[model samples]
Target: MSVVMADEAKDVHTEQLAACVRYVPPEDLKVVAQTYDGAPVMSGSVRGVQAHFREKHPQAVYVHCYAPDLNLVLCHTCKAIPEASDFFNLLENLFVSQCVYSQHDQFASIQEELHIEQRELVQISNTRWSCQLSSVNALMKNFPAVMKSLQKIRTPTALALHSKLSKLPVVYLFVVFKKLLGITEGFHKVLQKENVDLAQVVHYKSAVHDTLVSQGTAQVAEEIYAKAKAACRENNIHESSLGPRRKQKMGDFVVEVSCGSRSDLLNDSEHLKQRLFYPCINRMTSELENHFPNVEKEVMIGIQACLPASETFLCMQSLEKLASQYNIQLVPEEVMVTKSFLSRKGTEAISDILSVFKPLNPMMFPSLKTILQVTLTIPDSSCERSFSSLC
Candidate 1:
């Protein structure tokens, strides 16, 4: 997802939002328009994204009516698009407020919509079998509906219904055996987890069991099932309510440096130079300790803010190179890397330059911090005249 400055963003995160809304286009539009129906294609450009959606999901009238340019759409749709004004329609229910939709937002839309028609025969068979016999009510309900609607016809109509069911992924043993006969038992464990409120019916289980039982290969299916359970028993799955734990964000702390406010007549010029940013540097270290874990005197973390467009980046780069050679990371935890003006220049931050060769967190990789020679770029000769006159 895209990260943006809130102030400049007008309290928005557009880039990240675009990722979630990318898949609103309906499938009917894709089929009707004949634009690569069910084909694997990547969205190559954003120039005509609105037009693309109109062509893909015409049935979703809202998308066609409110087509937006790339920049605007990105901002408006990063989070869930709720139907209700109260945000009730959002996938997240109450009590799980902290849990976001997903950090991997860009792929989320694609995965939710990119369905292939029973490409994996083994998986299809398993599902069909489950629908026919197991708690898979959706499938069982559909079969009778087909039958009742066609009851006016003779026995031939009934056979056609059977044919349709057999062709479905469930009865088609080839579908299950082809590619999808996998992890039935493992998936069952996930559904049965105490925390899960969703019903626990190992989908495709009955179908696979029935097919294998009929084929006299139930022994093989049982072995595969046993292995799946063993794997789950040994492994730990961590579904994050909170993504990765991180040190306090740089924005969370305020910058308060004790410096001489430009005194009258430049009276204390030398004194001011002696400690202009000394307090800030010390505070930086202290802030690092309070916010981050296992931070040393010099470990750096990701800069919360982007580098300003000026000479600051150059200054930061120099400091980063020098800091690299020092012995650090005694405790070795998350390292904070920030871009600073003193060592950076021209749209680049100290962290940006250091990132080329330095470790993300000095606390994690002491050796990642190494001193390197850096070339300095002062102003042209024209500035020398002003400097000399001032001197």
Candidate 2:
């Protein structure tokens, strides 16, 4: 819970982190976990700050913060399609273009005329998926009003933006991301919460992974296109036909092949689904699996099983595994006695469980208390939030 300004180097971070740990009293100092962002200086495996620090404190397990990992999952997943990159850039351009006082006033008036609530456009953030979701939602809700504002301005930039928004591909991408980000919004919020723990993280991570997998079908893509088409009609924008035939290279001779009938909007929608929508969904699910493999590790599984909120709370095998991994000696019979008492209380939070032992002897179930204390010390997004406040 400290921030220090220094050169962004591995040695500097190692020194600062050590200083922070030393600030604690010698008898009470115990670094159970070290959570950090994926910066090269901090997370680089061999020569990184985390590695250097672990030499002095071998018990400190390194954890890459879930919030930033989730952000990377989204940032990389969106890169699966060229159109997604352009789509987010367009959102930024739209937000920046309206920053002028007169332009914002004009857009606000247009919203009033269209019976849409006046709302400021949200700029997409690379490190914050929630902000990206908000930006997409804001643009989607204000689509008609934005088109009218662009038409009234008669400026080159406005005209360009108007043309881009009126296109079938852009609108289709809009629909695709709306659903994608909507599915991610819940998991994103859970990761960013102040009190979030390993148990909640595991739950929501699996939930989002399953949801993305379930929604990757061609039927879902077609439904998304239908929504996009309806949005185009609502704004009085005619759907554009598919692009020209794609040129192919065969034995050094260029051959032009028709992708589909250019006049068929249904064919165009199918092409967009195959090319963009399904790939985006598939890439997202893959990234989730790649970035969060640690959640399935034995130690993490044991941690989740120990939490009262978990369905498998107080699982004996998991508890033993956790104790062994951390080298905490626990008497199984005594632990089960505590578990039996806690099962009746049904406490949801680590703090509540700790409170139940306040009246008992300090030596009673000492290992269980130590486990809970270490669990409580595991960081979530609090450090990230603190850094954000500095900005």
Candidate 3:
């Protein structure tokens, strides 16, 4: 319905959009709401497209794409955790060289040898977190097979890469992020579903928050170490450690521990957990919380005013404010009728509320139908996916 242009100036963009709206016949162009990425340019500062659109198209409402915003948050978080960024880079390189082209046969052979499924590695995309996650999961599932494949390559570069991959730091990060990404990927799928409802959006956000809250740093660190140890055992790879350093004539010499069976193994585990494991988990959770703010309050308020079918999380102030925002006059008799209908219906959903009142005469219901239309129209994030497809 829209065209992309190089000029991103708000006035120019909005002007073009306004022209398009004008070009459409008045009867056909009904309920013009815009759904866009939640970037500064679109919802820029105080005076942005949201404001401009409101002024021009009085009935139009602006909605931000929730999933894309969450994706952006994860994108920034990847940058924040250097180890994770490096691991993701490794996954991309592995995918291109081994998964896609040259050594794919070798990888498949190794997977067969290891008695694992012959799954192809996922290709990573800049915009898709799910891609990154699937890539990580493939790597984790076939880590031993992948390492064995590299060893069988009989190339200096492959051998050197194998050496780098054996390090504890890399392995620990791989395991930690693998679990975290699994959680996030689930959330992403739920948000992008077609039947996703307004109440479910609020419900899922709380569920994610609670899940993150339940996973404490120490517990997460423990889980990471356990997984890393299991991977080491399964692969028959010796987990080496930089053992104690002793004073020498040359200054100091550090001894290397070949097997991770030393008395200070617990100490080593704790040290790694403190240094690397805890920080990344904290960063991701904090960033997620910051990005997914409690829009539930305002959303519930608005819904209650329009639908007023459910009493859960309802506030009178929110109802009044929402009414003012939509310029709807909430007469006492109308409120009584709405509440009485709800009482008989026994707390119906927004869609059901709309259907219930749809058959009623407009003269008798007046503002109720308008409220139902506005309230039932939940903002969707699927527009971004559709736009990406067109591009």
- Which candidate leads the pack in lDDT? 2
| Model 2: ten consecutive residues of lowest lDDT | 17-26
* TM-score winner: 2
Per-prediction TM-score to the true structure, in the order listed: 0.18, 0.83, 0.75
Q: Residue 106 error for model 3, in Å?
A: 1.2
State how far residue 270 of model 3 sits from its true place (Å).
2.5
Query: What does candidate 2's lDDT look like per residue over 1-391, in tens digits?
Result: 1111112213324422212221111125566667666777876779987788778877666667677778787788767766677789999999998998898999999999989988889988887888888998999899988998889887999999998898888888888888988998988888867666665677678889999999988789889989988888898988756566568788978877555423222337778887779888888888998887452276676676655656766677776666776688867776777777665655543333234434334377677666655554554432565455322
Which whole-number lDDT from 0 to 100 does residue 346 have in model 3?
52
lDDT (Cα, 0-100) at 339 in candidate 3 = 57
lDDT tens digits by residue: candidate 1, 38-86: 1122121243432355465432111110001111221222222211111
Local distance difference test values of all predictions, in order: 0.24, 0.71, 0.61
The regions of model 1 sitting more than 4 angstroms off are 1-137, 141-145, 148-151, 154-159, 166-391
True-structure Cα RMSD, model 2? 5.3
